[model samples]
Target: MRVYPEQLGRHLTPLAQCYCLFGDDAWLIENARSQLLEAARQQGFEERISLEQDSGFNWNDLQNEWQALSLFASRRIIELTLPQAKPGADGSAMLTGLMAQPNPDLLLILRGPKLAAEQTNSKWFKTLDNAGVYVPCNTPEGQQYFRWLDGRITANRLMLDSDARQLLATLYEGNLLAAEQAVQLLALLAANRRVSAEELSQYFDDQSRFNVFQLSDALLGNQQQRVAHILAQLKAEGTALPIVLWAVFRELASLLQLKTAMVQRESLAPLWSKLRIWDKRKPLYEAALSRLSLPQIEAMLALSSTLELKLKQGGEEDWTLLTHLCLLFDASAHSALVDTRG
Candidate 1:
């Protein structure tokens, strides 16, 4: 049976013999897996085995491990982490065969990225679905993202006013891990007190641990100095280049889409609604969009595409290229500021 991540907790009591937890979100996937493991332990699954499916991984090994008797515990939990989410013909057959006869003593957990629709409809997947639970862990965006943040704040026993929540939602937009850490930090520092937008600024300034989301915000908001400082910090901390590129690409794409829709004389309400762009963020996008022309946006998109390829090809100048792209925003914003001053 298929289940949502939130519903997994209740279903754990009458645990299925097998479960497939698949998604692209690392945070959600890890969180669900951790919960499942804890539930299995509570249900007397005392012995645990973990297998990472990678190059040279043998399907036969899974069978061997599954059939092997554990002297230490009567019940066992087997975790298979599939990075690619593709099980070859042989692996599929093995999995289906294993599920043919459900063993009450063995609990199987398969974790991986989001599977293609066709993959989900496969015979082996059907068998697993019939015999176990399938939970999706897709990353939440827009309102869903805000609800998640609200839950995190409540769970951490920290309170944030409307403005503070909006600020955080923008600051840590695509990075849930960072948002979680921020919530924890707030909980510790605020001691369950309600925090406002102005108060939160101090935490960010003092912490000096800006993430990709913050970098995107700074770039869009035309905070040149802040952007430069955050970029340097990210490089020093060895943040992955791909992550930074992803944030930049996402923002550029949004602006391009919005600009296109506006040019066509279409109502922005529908477009914003479809994009899941909340009221709080509408102003930010509008401000950035007003400053950026279609040609500039297109140029940036082209640059982003080239940078992505270069990064993939293991280019030595990847950092230099990324720095240059970031500074493009800085230069544009600086020019606008200078023009206004004159």
Candidate 2:
């Protein structure tokens, strides 16, 4: 069975014995995991929960924990976190095989960041898709985001009037984590009082208009300052270089797909929605499509390929090359577009 984050509230009642959760947005996936865990506790699975990370993961340890069950317990829950699950790797291979014949007595939950675009259509991903539930945590949009906010409000046992809800939505945009936190703060502020829209700012001063989505949008908008600011924040947030590269590559790949489909006389709108790109990213995507042709995209991809190899091979200049690569791509997009116009 497959479930979306929007359907999670009701669909979680019938969680299968195993699940594979992965997507671009981290907050949504983490939110889904929490909700599922709470539901499991309701099903009397509190004490049986076990967690594991992907790095230095011991197959024996996982198998042992999963296979063993308390004589007194009805079911065991195993939650595995894979920060990165590349295709053909040992972890990905083992998981692909395990999902083929998941343990009936155990509820195996796998969480990971979005697979690289190149790996999206891999056999392992296909296997997971075929074998069990997949909750893709791509960024929620528009009314879906409002609905998600309402769900979170209700979950936290708080009340917000219609106006208040709309205000909160506008303030936080699509930032799930920040929105949830802001609502929690509101709940605390109005512990026994009914919160209204007017009182929102009084309780919390929300000051974020450029989140990850906006940063991506800035790149598309060709706003170098905004992009630079975002990159700095990303660095401060400890975002991995590989993760940043993956996101940029994925976006570029999607644009290439959209461009190809457009040339083929197919609809690009559906692809945009399916990609779960926020409204702010539309201009960015448009700009990128205009700025980069197929050949340019291929060139950038080739550059990333070389960068990846160099990083793996190791050297003092690897860091310098990575910085240069990011700058070169950034400059290429802006300069190439300008030159085309000139």
Candidate 3:
């Protein structure tokens, strides 16, 4: 009886007497609810009633609603939104009783938050589920996240190459509502054309208040606390993970290059100019180099590479990796973390 949001349409046919939609993602749950209502409407479910379960909600009111006849239309849909996702003793008995004696003219829909394992295994839930459809609307993550984005793009009649898709994904990885809005804007402005990665700038402005440059300065200066603070701020502001990764990766690579040349006793002036290390910023690099050896720089570079790989593979909590990579510049902080783990 369990159906995913993607497969709801296929199973919705023949129209089950009742449906239970529950999830952690409000957007997904709302979307599924709309789909179910539209299907009900098509099958002559002209009259609709909506109820939100609250502190004062009475199970008897629902029973009365189910028993009473609707004058506006013979076919009716009753939607009950459960904010608690918990139907206590009274509500449970009522639901099980109603399940045993379903009204031929009524289409019941119960929408609620995600349920715990114990709740799912309860007798009342199992009974209700046996009589109808149960759709879990959890948000997709990792590769599934990209698949959802791609589906949205196709449904909106827009074409996006791989780069453009990645760009769109980065812009709204955690903020699905905003991502949906952005896609709608794109559809209205320019649908049916292949969107390049570079063109995304026209529609969505940079929403991040803090830039990665600040992070770089903090890292090279070996300011561990400032690095952590800046990373947290960036994540809070919805800064793209890849943008942050590239900036840190760039710094790590540059440090490795400079550290290697210094170990080989190479000339500093030409190397500084070639690496685009400005005169004012030379002091920061020099100060960092004073304490770090070749091995440390190489190790940092390896860690940066691992971070990049994780980002591409869709690491959970990418901000943590970003924070770790940047803080590695401070040897004391890195050593403290190692000691603590020991």
lDDT of 3 at 80: 91
Q: TM-scores across all candidates?
A: 0.64, 0.57, 0.64
- Against the true structure, whose lDDT is highest? 1
Q: Which has the better TM-score: candidate 2, or candidate 3? A: 3
Kindly provide the TM-score of model 3 when superposed on the true structure, using C-alpha atoms.
0.64
Candidate 1 lDDT over residue span 94-206, tens digit each: 99999986899899999999899998999989999999999988877657878888888888887889999888876775567777789888988998478999999777732
Go through the candidates in order and give the clash count of each: 0, 1, 0
Q: Which scores better on TM-score, 1 or 2? A: 1
Lowest summed lDDT across 10 adjacent residues in model 3 is found at 333-342
Q: List the global CA lDDT of all models.
A: 0.81, 0.67, 0.80
* Ranking of candidates on lDDT, top first: 1, 3, 2
Distance from true location, Cα of 141 in model 2, Å = 4.1
Question: What tens-digit string does per-residue lDDT give for candidate 3 at 34-143?
Answer: 89888888888999998888999999998988988899999999999889888889999999999998776899999998889988998878987999999988767557
